[model samples]
Target: MKKANLTKIILSISACVLIGFLSSFATRSSVDTWFLTLKKPFFNPPSWLFAPIWTILYILMGYSFSIIWNNKGQSRKSKEIIKNAMMLFGIQLALNAIWSILFFGLCNPFLALIEILLLWLMIFETIKAFKKVDVYASKLLIPYLVWVSFATILNGSIWFLNS
Candidate 1:
């Protein structure tokens, strides 16, 4: 790849990692104190699994977004479509971070459940939009969507058990 393209990819990954890092602050503060005390569902994965899973997911998200960003749409309408798709991606990314703040920072799993539903929808919309520009990019997001689907269930269960 060209130097400029490589730079863009690096930046995109950095953006995703930065978001994850910031969100983790909220999580780290609570994991040992608040989170460990909660009554998690039977299906809840072991505590050790979350960090690595999220790390991989975030990397995938970054690569998927970079694919969309680097797509060469020729027409004005196509460019507009790409812009809209990217905007959706941004919204979902924000929601992802907000979830950690809501659940861990504020210690509110109920509110986090509601926010996660919105995040799931936004991710779905992002996938659809990405497919219009680049099928591969859209495919790349499927794991993220699936993971979020599972997480939504996990969040709901946590709320149900705790509340």
Candidate 2:
């Protein structure tokens, strides 16, 4: 790859990873105090599992974004299509970060549950938009989608059990 393209990929991956670490601030602060006391569902995985899983997910998310970003548009219409897809990608990424704040920072499972649903929808929309740019990029997000789907269930279950 060209140096410029390599730089873009690295920057994209770094940005995504940074966002993930920023989001983790909430979880890190609350995990020992607030989160430890929560009434998690029986299916909830061990605490140590989240960090590595999220790391992998964020890496995949960045790679997926880069694939779409690197797609060369042949026309104005195509460029517009790419632009819209990137917008969706940004929105979903922001939503992903907000979920950590809502659930861990604010310590509100109910509110988190609501926000997670929105996050889930945004992810689905992002996948659809990315599909228009690159099918493989869209495919890359399936694990993220599946993980978030499972998280939504877990969050809802936690809300139900605790409330």
Candidate 3:
């Protein structure tokens, strides 16, 4: 790979890892305290599973984004498409962090459920947009979408059970 592309990949991955790291601040404190008190569903995975899973997901997300970012279109329309795809990626990324804040930091699963629905939509739209730019990039986000889908169900269940 060219130095430029490698740099973009590293930066993209670092940015995603950084976001995950920062988001953990909200989660770390509550996981042992507030989250433990909640009524989780039987299917809820062990608490220790989250960190590694999230780290992997974030890495995938960043690599996928780097694919889109490095895509240099030859036409005006292609450039526009890439721009919009990147914008969607950014929006969904922000929503990802916001969900963490709402659910863990504020200790509001109900609100988090609502925000996660939007987050899911953004991820879906982002996938669609990424597909237009790079099919592989879009494919890379599939696991993230699936995981968030499961998380949405989990969040709703927790809210229903606890409320």
For all predictions, the C-alpha RMSD in Å is 2.0, 2.1, 1.8
User: Among all windows of ten consecutive residues in candidate 3, which has the lowest summed lDDT?
Assistant: 1-10
| CA lDDT for candidate 3 | 0.92
Residue 71 error, candidate 1, Å: 1.5
What stretches of model 2 exceed 4 Å from their correct place? 1-4
List candidate 1 segments past 4 Å from native: 1-4
What is candidate 1's lDDT per residue for 1-163, written digit by digit as tens? 2112676778888899899999999998899999999999889998899889888888888888888888767999999998999999999999999999999999999999999999999999999999998888888899999999999999999999999
lDDT of each: 0.91, 0.90, 0.92
lDDT of 3 by residue, 38-148 (tens): 999999999889899999999999999999899888999999998999999999999999898999999999999999999999999999999998888898899999999
Q: How many residue pairs clash in each candidate?
A: 0, 0, 0
TM-score for each model: 0.96, 0.95, 0.96
Q: Per-residue CA lDDT of candidate 2, range 10-86, in tens?
A: 77788899999999998888989998898888899998899899999988898888887887789999899989999
| Model 3 segments more than 4 A misplaced | 1-4
Best by lDDT: 3
Q: Where does candidate 2 have its weakest 10-residue lDDT segment?
A: 1-10
TM-score of 3: 0.96
